[model samples]
Target chain A: MRKKANPFFYLFLVVFVFFVMFPFLWMLLSSIKPLSELFGDKAFTPFSSHPTFQSYVSVFVDYPFMRYLWNSAVVSTITTVYTVIVASFAAYAIARLQFKGKTFILGIVLSVSMFPQIATISPIYIFLKNIGLTNSYLGLIIPYTTFALPLSIWLLVTFYRKIPGDLEEAAKMDGATLMQTYWKVIMPLAVPGMFTTAILVFIAAWNEFLFALTINTDTNYKTVPVGIAMFQGQFTIPWGEISAATVVVTVPLVIMVLIFQRRIVSGLTSGSVKE
Target chain B: MKNSGMEGQAGVELNKQDARLPVKKAPKRERQKKESRAALYLVAPAMILIFIVAVWPVLQSFYYSLFDLRLSDPKKSEVHLKYSVDLGRYLDNYPFLISSIDSEIKKGNDAAELQDIKEKLQSLDEKLQKDPKVKSQYNAVNDKLMNFKQPSEDIRFADVEKSTAEEFSKTTESVSSQLNKAAKKTEFTQEKKLLGLASGMKDSIIKPTFIGLKHYKEDLTEPRMWRALGNTLTFTVISVAAELVLGLAIALLINKAFFGRGLIRASILIPWAIPTAVSAMMWSFLYDGQNGIVAKLFESVGIVDKMSNLLTTSTGAMFSVIFTDVWKTTPYMSLLLLAGLQTIPSSLYEAASIDGAGKWKQFTNVTLPLLKSSILVALLFRTLDAFRVFDLIYVLTGGGPANSTETISILAYKVMFSQTNFGEGSALSVIVFLCVAVISMLFIKFLGRDLLNDGNGAGR
Candidate 1:
């Protein structure tokens, strides 16, 4: 049986959760407030006298936010799919096969993940410009996959290592080919790991800013993060529209976190803790 | 009798099987080879993509650091191997300038000065056309100029000897400046055209600008780069240190079986889960000078004299950014520590209690010692990330309030993209990479050694 928690523990927990959730709560409240209430003299009021969806409507109407959302979806979805497929192949090789230079390859992935994106920005911009690939979905997707590969492969490798070797051995004994064994036996069990990797990579791609800002100058190709950042009016910022945009982009991610909290936690720790 | 006979027959069969073992081993070796090849095949796609997307770009950036590349100037936009001429540019303006000079002389005003300038220009043009290839290209360019058609880039440029390029550039510059001065003494119909065309021709004398190490030298001497780096260091150190302490406390609290543990754990991830850019925008609102809740709280609590001070003052801006970063990332730090906490056996705390040790004593002896590696890992990740902070500062402040919050990454972005100075920008990028490499090296050398020592201790 667990020991009874101390009274101070509850007090500390309350403070901790309050600190953690305060900004989010503030953002939510700001999003629903009408402009007059938001910028009024008594803006410090906890809630608006009248709650409205005007900011949300204005976000979609004032800018091409729907287009930006579509762009982010297209780029992020493709990046997630490609990153998973590519990382899975390599992760399987490293985890299951005995190969030369495996340690060297793993080291490369680790070091590359630590590479600062700023270092590669200029060259990648010049390269994409030369090849006429800038402002296109492929341009952003390529770098996103490169940056996400190392983490995706690392997490999947740990996951692959924990599966019983006997399963694959049994499949091979039953006259299954290598592809058949992986597809029919190994992959079915690795779905949870793959889902975790996909979610992490999708969030990364959706949230990446430097590349999105550098690669696409056209308004039509801007992702939500870049587009939202570029929301400036003549004299001051449109905080209402920005807050609405933030809520729109962030709610989906929060929902994903709610649905896959355990998987995300495991994936994060496995990649970092070296267990 | 039957068993003895079967044994003798089995002995003969065993001898035959042993003789065929070499043949079977050869196929096994080949199978192993095939498997290795398959492994290579499986990893090839990812490896090749990484080389293209990650490795090649770094190499390209390194290559660009060796030149004086600026996109604003036409001559310096691309790398030049040798002295070359924009013959079309020269021809487009040189002939018109000569005719305008002819008209000036025809007006019989400052005829001697005009004649001297015309002779110099004619000689420079002749020197440029001295090379046979250049002569051919020059004639083609003149024809295109006469026809009022723009010359293609390939046909407009031709390589020249270094001496010829120097001589032509000097002559054109001298002539252009002289024409400007001479025009001051006269009021002629073609004075404006003459000066305009002459100045235009001065830029047409393309000279090679391959200044290796110049960008690096400038960046190394510039105070702004160092200041940006100092700001980054300040942010990294303070924010990481704060997160470490707070994260440990949270990890200790949650390590025990608590009611609603799952809900608390998930809620903690909300700040970390939000995109950094989005959260930065949220903080910008919370730190807004006019109507920010945090600013109001700070003002009311006497943290600042005014609400706008949080973002408008340099120290306050730094404090605000670091505090926001700590708030967003402490959960991540706590989560990592929580994983470490779970690994520590409950028996240690129980044993401590049996020995009559207090909570603080038990933490110092058991928890801190065991949690070192996790703390090291978390610090390393956060340090590297905070050092390379770009999106947060970029969106929230644009490194504003006189660039008090600018980091090296923001400076590099401003140089490379906004100012379009790729050479200096690439040098800054290389500097940032070197700093990061040093930081990682220091972490691995020190922290990794501790981890090793702990492993050996455990083994003993």
Candidate 2:
């Protein structure tokens, strides 16, 4: 049924995989090494003679990493939930209903996605400061939702278009109103699409650094990326602790990617590629 | 007889239904109107949120760029349309300075000159209190200071006429200089303290710093801004071109139905899944001067002359950043192109092969042409992203080794937060926004014409 693969194909695959995974492997190896070997000449050794979890222990004890993790989780969760709900409603209206100025609205959404965050950060910081929302979770959540809405809406619109229109017509024939049909009939069928968008938005919010760095500067409100960036030591740079923290923050994201690779790929490529 | 009766009844019913068609059209029109209204309701929340967070802030940044706003200077921290005076600062030093002068006059060292200076100071105080608004604010601030309570910002400053402000500043400056001269000539103990208070009073006069378009003109002529822009363009072009070639190769490799393709795809996402800041930090470690493995490898392999040369030298730092970016983002590029590759039917390849085309010929004739739109779209996204790079370079070299690697966004951030020059920073931000708009327009006009039409159809 299929031709046998060539030796060069496997060789190329191994090389590609090695190139992509080298950093992660190195990161993992470096995280497990003790400080003495990490900074000493033995650092070039492929494996440490005495690998330990001291860096991981120090990361949790020496810094307020647990708080950073909690903050990132809270902000990212709220942003993902808020963005998906609002974007879903807007996407449905554009996909399933005929409305005036639909093209104009889509244009606005598209342009907003391409807007550079640096340009809008100053006013956002000032506004949040005025309202006493800076250094709070709500400040980050609001901007994250605003930035994530465009992509989520675009992805959901593509998904919503794939569902047959006859289903809604059938619901209408059964005496269901427009709102009821949207709530009970269409939403259940669109759950997978919403889930895919949720994953993409969550990763985006988790990875957002600029707003989190500028807006929430208080130690109590720092997220993972900002917290890691601000790590320091008296004389030497704390490479082991930083590597441990990076490993801690990145493992969950890697697992998520592994589990939902297909969904994420489809969500990313939905608008760009033709079906 | 039954057939004829049924036919006659059916004909009568059809005629009645046809007569009611015009009447039914009214409700259909009303339903269409209601649906449009419902669409507005559904879209209102997202639109309002975006306007609040994104659109309104850009307008506010534009407005702020029109004035001189520096957080370091107390007087210029806030925008002032009219001349005003900080009564708290004025009252704090005014009473002490007057007493010091009076004490000097009592000592009778330069009694005649001191008397003349006292009379001038009295007239300046009277000139200031002549305004009813200033008098009330002055009294309130003085009372609060005496009671050891701090005055609020709103009541601390009071607006004054331009002429009155000019006279007050002039008298204080001259009197301070005279006092300094007197302190030098006479060994008066309180004269030093007196001069200190007098100099502090000079800053109480708050002049409006609303120089319109000054920051924009300065930034436009500034060599640093131009260099930063140039650096951003160089990074965007070189890194994107590298990613395109490598990503196309990876896409072609994975498009074949091979064993463990899923595992390869998943592993490829690891680089992309890591945050840019974290990756930048990782590369910084790998490129460390003494103990870095990658740096040593490069030196031994003859890519660089020394291990430390990777991040310490300007060209090497730029190369290091671009290399890290290509490593981090090639997976994303590959994925996008792979999506495009998957869309190409197998029959096309089969037809080409049947026509006696080789692998390279097939790729040139079929894959390149079909993948053009995807490549363009991917380049547009990656170019814009690379132009606005902040987290990577910010954490890596900090735009340093003499700021040779600074991009526009990094420069804007430094100007805004590190230096606390919001007005100039805002001007830079507006320029960045304009560049982004121009880039988007160029992409759409030249390369994305069909893509835009396709996007509109998909949106509809």
Candidate 3:
């Protein structure tokens, strides 16, 4: 298409791509290898050799990896659903509602979202534990809802703000109560924003390792990250086992991203809300 | 285009074109209190959970830091049986020996039948009481006996010497016997274990409690803790700085439309999107000194003449852990910065070019200042994350080779889960929160406002 290209530029790009993908590719490749081969004579190219399905089998057979996946799925789905429902109204208030301390409330929620998980996990763990929610689905669900609400509220607020007030005023004049108007009116229109918020909440909940790991000790209640971290710890960390499990686990997330490619807004994901 | 679209939907003023939208329609001020009450009620579930898990934890940890609490015992603050078998003790022992045995009355060397061999092995170990050579090798033998199998033939595992190796032979024999007994016992319990696993876990683990700040004070005052803290900060600062710069560069470079751009974008995200725990595990293996990829790279590049284990030495271990962390998180840093880059209006660039601004000047005067929010967000998130870093270090190095990579988070974990030192762990948790707050406040002072403001402009 052009004059001779800069070989160095192409080379740099190739190297960069390779560097970025090498670990994940290695992960996928290594997952199929037997433990012996994974830990074989340590060569960078150990991945290129004969691979096996032993690790995958072992992860399924030896551990409750499937339970972990189910836990993650259930938690993420509930969190996402609840988050959208809760946050849409909350954000609408912040964005369009006239109320005292609106800015303060919005700021508070935003600050909550920014609050480090580590800073909050200890106290949360104790409180949840006291309620017999520790190591329970209810415990995990409640926390997930709490942590996700802020971001959901923030993003949905932006989306709600973008919707013309006339749309809501018409419904309000129709004598729809606020809840009905929010559910039947603002919601039907904010599908795109809702989807964006849902995906983000799901991702956050799915990948959350800190609170999940600390609070839940039982494998059945544990989410994927904790499941995997603890799952194969008994054995010498089999890259094959971890890799295969990771693939099984991450494939769903990857598929989700791919299917919802439209939602993949690299900027804070959909840039659906301002802080 | 507008007329064509409006023609079908038009009965109700399709010509109305105001972008001003009411996010909410509040009633008169007289009814405001009623709405506020309703609003609080609606948000109660989420707020209550937040208070319980997030807010309560911070406060409880602070409160617990004030008094001694223990999990291993309801009376835990009492320092009885607090010490546990740990890496240091394990290393210092070089091998654990149960006891010494008198070497007498052994049949011919048929490697001893698995049962008799274990008995003989157990006795031989017991007789090593005063013998340094036998005792030193005792622990290693005992481990193999307990494990009942050979360590994998990874480059990561070095060969025990022949002299030490022989001791292992006897240990293996003992393990075979133990395995038989375990198999027999499990055969009966198989059905029960399958169903009772949940109950078992619940029974075994005691509930966690709030312990006071004794441990945090100890960590602060202790030289070892301070040294570890210093190392962690140094590692976090250097690696995070490198990652921020590198991520920005990479994101900017890849942001442009190019051949295979989609593929490259996904590729870059692959490393980031993979769980950090998985990456840490992979890198730890790669950092294996012998036959390791990292070692090979270093050797060939002449950085070091010999195959040096990055995990075995203090400085090397620190460097290895930090390098691995940077490699894994740089993509995330880049992605955040990239989002920031996209938010910047392209008109500014056009205007700059019209003003005769050079590329470097445009980047410095226009691009950088504009990207400030994104940079601040990226820096704040990454720095806070690095301080609490545990999964990576736990999987990669286990805060190893003399605890060089140990951060407050890891210490909190060990104190709570491992030692069952709830008081100490709670104290440490409060400290960790303080550390995070201080760092975050500093970030806010420096660039936090821009990042917060950027959030508004971020969501389109």
The best candidate by lDDT is 2
Against the reference, the lDDT scores of all candidates come to 0.83, 0.85, 0.63
Please tell me which predicted candidate would have the highest TM-score against the true structure. Answer: 2
Model 1 Cα RMSD, 1 decimal: 6.2
- Which 10 successive residues of model 3 chain B have the least lDDT summed? B96-105
CAPRI quality level assigned to candidate 2 from its DockQ score? medium
Q: Which has the better DockQ: candidate 2, or candidate 3?
A: 2
Best by DockQ: 2
> CA lDDT of B237 in candidate 3?
95
Please tell me how candidate 3 rates in CAPRI terms. Answer: incorrect
User: Clashes in model 2: which pairs?
Assistant: none
Error of 1 at A80 (Å): 0.9
Q: Residue-wise lDDT of candidate 3 within B1-460, one digit each (tens)?
A: 1222332343144223221333243434544576666676665665565566566666766666665666656434332222211212222222222111111112222322334534654453354333454344445544654676442223112223344334544454444444345445443223233223212211211222333345666778888667667876987798899998899898777555456655655555555655677567667656667535666676688765665656777777777778888887887677777776776777888889899999899899987998776687678778877887878887777778788778767767777768766666776666666777788888778864543443333222
Give each candidate's interface RMSD in Å: 7.9, 7.3, 5.7
TM (B chain), model 3: 0.62
TM value for model 3: 0.71
Estimated TM-score per prediction? 0.90, 0.91, 0.71
**Between 1 and 2, whose lDDT is larger?**
2
